[model samples]
Target: MTNETKIPNTRWWRILPATVLVYIVANIDRANISFAMAGGMMEDLGLDAVAIGMAIGIFFWGYLLLQVPGGHLAERKSAKHFIAAMIVIWGGCATICGFISTSFEFNVVRFILGIAEGGIFPAILVIISHWFPPAERARANSIFLLSFPLSAIISGPISGWLIATWGWREMFIIEGVASIALIFLWMPLIADRPSKAKWLSAEERNWIESELAAEAAAKKAAAATNKSATKTSYRELVFDINLWKMVAVYFLICCAFYVLSFWLPTIIKDILKADIGMVGWLSALPNIAAALGIVFFGRMADKSQNRRKYCIIPYVCVGLCIIASVFTASYSGWLSFAFLCLCGFFWLSGHPVLWTIVAETFQPEVAGGARGAINALGNLSGFFAPMLLGYMIQNYSRDAGMYIFAVLVFLAAVIVWSMPKNAETKAAVEKTREHVAATTNAHA
Candidate 1:
């Protein structure tokens, strides 16, 4: 079918299922390390918390380096093929992680894993941007993000059990196999954009086109008029104030999130003096809270149509919770459990809206690249959060670690608040729509 003939009525119903499955595997692979660490990988490897954190953080090093290129590739390639290829490679690496005995080997596998997985989130974001209109974007993002929490929920208990019964390596192999299975399932379902979807209804296509066109037009006009111009260059994103602000936001969020991912299982185990089975179940609690948090924040952003405040509020709340938890909770089982749930809820609440803003901020042609660049840059904190927190906990105290996280979370909120709103973003979006239309008309 011709591009024009195929543009309308994409069956989102079909695409969403496959997208969710891919997300689940991707997230589980990304996060299963937490389970490994808690399950005894650290002692077995004879590594300190700092060493483990550094190893885990190194994944971000590779992940960040490849983001822009990955984005560029996503723009040009078939999203399904790209995702499928990456999954098999990374998932295989993850499975192999189970067999490796040395820290160096672990680092190597993780670095490779990072490179392989770097493209998934940014590419998915770009795909979602094309598939859904601005009004529907948050909801779409929410649904897609559900995979993150769901993966955590599955990974936590299952991984813990695997670690207890079979060993951490076994957990990796099982999850890896699941990822490989998903690639085949995903192959037939994912297309690059709604325009390419074959099963969409004629009316649905027209409706989406109209919504996208209108939104894009407003974005363009705003961009054309904005005078406080921050000229975006491939190189200058590193130096750009707006980019830095975004980086700060990312860093802060990672502080909270990485802590939960890396340390929550340990915290639950330590606080309750729980055995492996109990620790596994307890690890799932925070993820459950996070899942609810993502859904709530996503729907709120969708309802409010305001990304900035929506993103900021939850982050700030997370910071407050971190501070409060450090003081009130005696590390008793019940208090720790309650605090974990609260921290998880608030800490994760910002992501859906933040991701939505990231999707809306860039031009479609380069959206993937920009998203990847920002995400890559922003992700630098992922490495540090684990390292820094682990160090603090080992040397200072858990309270000290929580305090540091509170500070970082608060810092992220400040940066988000400081960022000059691109009132022009909406206009730029609108202009792009008009440009696409004019080009289409000219061709006709």
Candidate 2:
């Protein structure tokens, strides 16, 4: 009867908070530019609407290239040092981004920031997959993801105030400094694997190790039962239709999310004709809605037995609300913003369920890389989404982009509704086999 056995839930508190903190900073760095753009960065740099979108979208381009490689590095090397080093690097990038005068400098910094920050999520997911058993994994993931919206909620007002008073440079440098300081906390606290968790008693260690092993065996058994969907390799992952389907679903979601995030302040300002401070506070409203949605949908995905049903609902809501907001914008500004808030809610909620499904789809052997790939490919939406919206807003109306987002997310919902489940992991293997056959037949 060790303390570890007595305190199974305690590690969760330690892990979740630290992980949450890292992502909060990551997202703030990722998203604070939106506030800056609205503040005075645009005017100072002489950026037009299209250029603004390009600056925002460019981060994902470098981030996209590193997905599989970064995951591999984290999996192969030391996650603690690896992740810490990247944070410090990106923190530096974030700080430097504040001083840049031209569009080129801004885009260069953004692309570098993407490269630095891109690996953290997948590596964290890989870490989470190791620490918790299957039963607890989804919830842990949800909590991790919840950090994004939570960070967004806080960043809006804080960034707005910082920009309004101290200026955009101050906001970036301050946030970047905060991220750099977090490295000390991370290096000391995080253990690469359960065996390395010095805080856990030997008995507790055994329990965790055994539990994870049993889960793996169970997954393997399920794979056996499903007739060998468990076989995976880098080759299979690239060619697998199912994985590609997941990527497509996430790309659509990313489009809506990045568009909403990068443009929300502008939209709010346009509606209310507000100052930077007011825009900051007003921008937080949708984030507040999104934060609640993340929590609600996290629990919803965990408790519900059917994955597709749970996943599809939020996306449908995203699509419908986005479209409705477009119509609502005609009559009432407040009403339109409210609908957009609802869209944020559903848009943010979709990730927990989507990743949960992705977890079930890929074997643990490849889950880390798989997540990186999904994130990489999916996040390409971040690049394209801003550009798309920039074009629409530049050419048409501010609300014009929402129509495309609505259609895309609706189609994503349909894809999720249509996808086959893991069938306990064997279905995943079967998918590969089927995909290979279909490809061969097509070429033949």
Q: State each candidate's clash count.
A: 19, 1
Model 1 scores a TM of: 0.89
lDDT of 1 by residue, 1-444 (tens): 223334443445766667777888888888888888877888899889889898889888878766887777777776667777888888788788888899999999998888888888787777777778876688778778778778888877788778888888888888887777777787777778667767667666665666666665555455555322333445544445555567668877886787777777777777778887788887787778878888888888877777888788888888887776667657456775787678777777787787777656554555677778778877777788888887887889888888888888888888778765645665565466666667767877
Q: What is every candidate's alpha-carbon RMSD to the true fold? A: 4.2, 7.6
**Residue by residue across 115-230, what tens digits does model 2's lDDT show?**
99988888887777778755456677878887888898899889998988899999999998888999988877788787888887665566566556655555565765542247
**TM value for model 2:** 0.91
lDDT at 38, model 1: 79
Could you tell me the lDDT of residue 265 within candidate 2?
89
Alpha-carbon lDDT, every model = 0.75, 0.80
Q: Return the lDDT, model 2, position 221.
A: 56
Task: Assess the local accuracy of residue 314 in candidate 1 as a C-alpha lDDT between 0 and 100.
Answer: 82
Best by TM-score: 2
